[model samples]
Target: MSAPDQLLVVIDAVARRSDGESVRIAKDVLCAGAAVKLCLPDTPAEFAKALARRGSRRPVVIGDDRALVRAVGLLHRGRELSDGALSLVPVGPHGSVDLAGALGVPLGAVAAARAVLDGAARRLDLLVDDSDGVVVRGLRVPAGPSGLAVIEPGSVWDTCRSLVRTLVRPAPSVPTIRTHRLRVEADGRVLSDLDDPVEGVTVLSRGGVAEVVVRPRAAEPVRVEASAVTISGASFRYRADALVTGPVWTRTWTVRPAAWSLTLPAA
Candidate 1:
């Protein structure tokens, strides 16, 4: 007999693939019966509420990376990260689906849904930001790019083409080197103070606390261990996965390990 179905999907209409074609494609693949209850959420909060109500059901998000990040953030905040699986169908602006690629989700909506249905569930790490925002991986921001911002709206065809091109292109290097006087504390120890100027710092941890800074002169990812960390900076923004957030001056992040799971292909 086939395994019992235990998957639920919630979608954000404002995010990527909010059009008719993408939606139809997702509905055709992911929402085909009593196994999956596909919900079209008008807002992120509503989606979160629906997800919280569906205990034990795996979450399959059908939007861009930002939508996926939002779902992850909700789980982290709800303290239910270790319980279920989260999958994605990346349908958004170009470069917005980088996190999906990192998580091994296929580019096409139907293929991604299949991966969710047939892929193996694996434990994955999460990065909690200063504002209590949680991400599956590191954040990225490009400094010297023109005509790359997602603010300007484009046609569906144009957006689709751009998304394809971005996924195939080489990862661009960060050009502008901006520094921040950051105060980072891990566990109970101070890793860096306000006096030091650093380009960027990545706080890495599977569960407990591990941090590494990407400075101008650093040889490799320097290890700094702690149970929790706090970062404070001035007038600067950082990338969280594919989204850019905050000039948030001070925020505290606590390490939560094995906080989430994802379906992956066998290695």
Candidate 2:
């Protein structure tokens, strides 16, 4: 398809802070001469509605990483991810837009918005889990005595405590780290057996395969590449993208090559 000249700007509620910077970014997009339809969605339902009504306009998400994930999930669910490319303007506190940075999106609102007007669409891979959860970046299965801590969003006290601990304490030692006995399978082959104690596991989709890295207690890390991976153990938690999930026995993720497209500055 040809490049989109009409755009749909969806601003998440959280990014509506900072003296209406999200709105100003939309205005900047409009001033650049693209036909823009701006929507300030305050809730998840509203966000869905706005996207559903996007018509032919290309979508530009104005918010943090979660907002981008929400839009991508909606598009993927609607089977429209391959139909058009999505753009993003990272609008939040300094460290909140890490995903955008990782995806090569300009950090500034104006630059990201302008990229929507004059950028190239690049197809990217995605990790689709068994439950249909999408992971854009990657995931980690922590190793330690406690394993991975469950961090719920909007818990101010928990956030403060964690922050304080990080600032005050020395780095955790290997013995203090929680370890789990996980069975990791990559494309049907077992990379790590359940009998082995693992320090951590990380998987990232690169090229057309999922790069699986298993860190064992006293051995060099094991790395493998496959299109699919399955992790099963007694009960473990994993951090997928920016969300933490599970205490479940098994979770499988398949790599979808070029599953989605994003607009990024031209090389």
TM-score of predicted structure 1: 0.73
Question: What's the C-alpha lDDT at position 183 in model 2?
Answer: 94
Q: List the residue pairs that clash in candidate 2.
A: 144-177, 144-178, 144-179, 145-177, 145-178
Query: After superposing candidate 2, which stretches have Cα over 4 Å from the reference?
Result: 1-3, 143-150, 153-175
Model 1 Cα displacement at 211 (Å)?
4.3
Candidate 1 clashes: the total is 3
RMSD of each candidate relative to the true structure: 7.5, 4.0
Off by over 4 Å in 1: 1-4, 15-19, 32-34, 129-131, 140-177, 187-191, 204-211, 217-227
**Residues 78-106, candidate 1, lDDT per residue (tens digit)?**
88777767777778766767778877778
Overall lDDT per candidate, in order of appearance: 0.67, 0.83
Residue 6, candidate 2: Cα error in Å is: 1.1
List clash counts for every candidate, in order: 3, 5
Query: Model 1: which residue pairs collide?
Result: 81-259, 139-241, 207-257
